[model samples]
Target chain A: MNEYNSLLINLSVFIGLLLIGYFVGGIVEKRHFKSILEREEKLLYFPVINLAPRRLVEIGEDLQIENCFFVSGLVVIGEDYFKRILGFLANFFGGRLLSHESLLDRARREAILRLKEKAISQGADMVVNLQLQYLSINKETDSQNANNSVEIMAYGTALKVK
Target chain B: MFITNIDYVPSLKIIEHYGLVSGSTVRAKHIGKDFLASLKNLVGGEIKGYTELLEEARDEAIDRMILQAEDFGANAIVNVRFSTASVAQGAAEIYVYGTALKVS
Candidate 1:
């Protein structure tokens, strides 16, 4: 009976250690993911400032299409929490992961809408730029793997159909 | 992505049959442990703070610039460009711009 009791105590301690280890791993993962988020936050501006400019202007306007438009966006995610859960069960550990849309996607949609508004302001029926870009930047690192994020962008021009 | 227009416009003029031009500007700042963590990237890793803050500011600045361009009765903004300045230590200034024009 005493032997069985000792085995049970050892089992319990092992379980405790495993759980603690998992949490510790999670904290580290969270730290890494946090920095990735920060990097994305800054990278997004490049589109607005560097990417948004440089539109292609045609020497001649196309009469068939009255409006041209472009759009873009970005999404970033950390990792799979399921993987973490599995690790914990395996006596290893896991961490919390984050998921988010690419800033580029957010930027693109907003930009095109602004263009549409511009068309309205000019009293033009449509537009004609019709171009955009999207990209992803991954910056996640861990004992197992590295993670990154994606970004999207949209741009276009508006013109009058008549 | 292939951009068909410029972000910065040196100037704009609207004439009869002349298409309208428009633009926007934005700026943002990120305050938290995020910035400090990014510094660790000085060793040649990704400095996320620079990317995150720049993205927010650029987007907002562009929106503002675009809205202002729309107010000017511009159909499109040509030759758009962006500029940056330090409004404060932890804050950044992002400016999105393009020429506003009007076409009849």
Candidate 2:
């Protein structure tokens, strides 16, 4: 009887996780993507470049650095329930982990966009010499793997052109 | 204060150069956030909680660097660089540095 009860509890917990991952995680991802699209459209005018500005007129017709400052954006992303399961299955078969591609992609895009937004708020014309750094921060766990974090940092210099 | 990642600013001229200044910070997410993140692993997607945590840490580090530059009487910071490392299982250390300069 005890063994049967334990089995039933485990099954219920598994189902609960699946339900949470499917419903809650889905809503979060969809909302995040929608917001990203809207923000990107609004920020289309801000020009973010990786090249250093050598001449004042290169960026704009009459541009000069009125106030220069450093800007940085960081995000640490993780996989969702569905993606984690897919990743596990893929690992067993030894193939490409395509499930994780979008995770990093979102992180990179969001970080860059945030950096540009910050520069624009500071009355900057453009952001230059952009740098990207990636890090992984995961905790060790006894029951499950503790390796599930991707950190992205986007940084640049903002030039307030006048 | 002006800050640029390159060795020189576009229109500003470097009048006096001070030594390098730097700032660093380490941060981690709360246990509640960690629990959510682990569940997220089941259906992989963007982790907003972790993103916010790291963003906050980076901003704090930059603020500290700016304070140091102010102490050096520098009007701008140039040649900025960033480095990060995993200090623990779920924590990161962010280090930012730049050269302080009096620009005109």
Candidate 3:
């Protein structure tokens, strides 16, 4: 009887945590997406290109060059408990993990927004030679406190033209 | 010094080259921060502690790279690139490199 009672308690705790994770994770994700959309619209006019210096010349536009500098932005996002459970199921089935996909998409967009903000602060006309680096850190499968986090870094050269 | 990620700086002429300069740094968060980050994983959002740690490490790496370029008597560095690696279980290494040049 005692063993059965302990099992019942454990199951209830597990279910309770799952419910909290689902509701809290959904609310947080929704708020984040709303903010991302609003910010993207505000920064839509800023031009960020991946073209090299030579390509700018090939474009045949007479740009009055003034100065240039480097800029970078970095962001780290953690996977929520609810999404992690979803990802595990997807992994077992050998299919796409859509939850993780949206996480990465958000991180990348946030990094780019930060980079553009820096370029604007430097009085840059446009950002060129854009580069991105994505990293997954602290993935210890055996550890209880495994930090399943993704880091995104966006960098580029900002050109101040006259 | 003027630093840019492109091969050339706009409106500037590279009169001399000083080869390559690079810098790297590895960092790990403190136990307290790591514990907090794990707790934050439950709700899932931006991990501000890890983000700040990485930004600080990257800045230090860039500063070291700039010092190396200065030692070479270069006034500028161009074609700068950044790379990151997981050196250990919880440590990250940030590496930056570029070509040092004298520009006017």
Candidate 4:
């Protein structure tokens, strides 16, 4: 009887945590997406290109470049409890972890936005030679409860004109 | 010194070149921060502690690379690239490389 009571308590706690994760995580994700969309729209006029300097001239702007410097942006995002559980289930079933996909997308976009902001602040008209680097931290642990986070770094060269 | 990830800096000419310069660093967060990060994982969001730690480490790596370029008497570094690896369970290694050059 005591074992059954303890099991009942454990199950209740699990359900309660799942509910909290779903509601809280969903709200946070929605809010983040809203902010990302708004900021992206605001920075739409700025060009962040991956072209080298030589090819950049082909874009037809007679740019009398004055100064150039390097800029970078980095972000680290983690998965919520509900999504982590979903990831494990997806792994067991051999399919895509959709939740993680959005996480990555958000991180990448955020990093780019930050890079653009930095360039804008430095009086750069455009950013060129963009590059991205990805790294996963605390992923060495095989345990299910391990904390896993992804780091996305966006970098480029900012060009200014006279 | 001017640094960039492109082969050439705009409005500048590379007068001299110094093959390549590289810098690397391995970093791990403290136990307290790690514990807090794990707790934060329960809710899902940005892990500020890990982000700041890695950012600082990356800056340090870049500084070291710049120092090496300075030793080579190069005024600029171009074509910079970054690579990362997990050297240990909790440690990450950030490696940056670029071609050092004198520009006019």
RMSD of each: 13.4, 3.3, 1.6, 1.4
Give the per-residue lDDT of model 2 (tens digit) for A44-128. Answer: 9888878776643564755555667778777766666666566567757977776567667677888888898888877888887
In terms of lDDT, the poorest run of 10 residues in model 1 chain B is B37-46
The lDDT per prediction is: 0.41, 0.77, 0.85, 0.87
lDDT of 1 by residue, A45-74 (tens): 222222222232333433443333333222
Which is the better candidate, 1 or 2, if ranked by lDDT? 2
Clashes per prediction? Answer: 100, 19, 0, 0
- Which stretches of candidate 3 lie above 4 Å from their native place? A141-145
Q: Is the docking of candidate 4 incorrect, acceptable, medium or high quality?
A: medium
Quickly count the clashes in candidate 1: 100
Docking tier of model 3: it is medium
Best by lDDT: 4
Candidate 1 docking: what grade?
incorrect
* Candidate 2 lDDT over residue span B34-91, tens digit each: 8887666665566778777777777788889999999989988889888888777667
Stronger candidate by DockQ (1 vs 4) = 4
Worst 10 residues of 4 chain B by lDDT: B37-46
Lowest summed lDDT across 10 adjacent residues in model 3 chain B is found at B83-92
**Deviation of model 1 at A117, angstroms:** 25
lDDT of each residue in A1-162, candidate 3, tens digit only: 999999999989867766776899778888988998998999999989999766878888677777788898889988888787777677579778888999999899999999999999879888889999875554566665465877999999888878
Report the error of model 3 at residue B92, Å.
1.0
User: Cα lDDT for residue B94, model 4?
Assistant: 94
**Once superposed on the true structure, which residue ranges of model 1 sit more than 4 Å away at CA?**
A1-162, B1-29, B33-36
Task: Write down the C-alpha DockQ for each prediction.
Answer: 0.06, 0.56, 0.75, 0.76
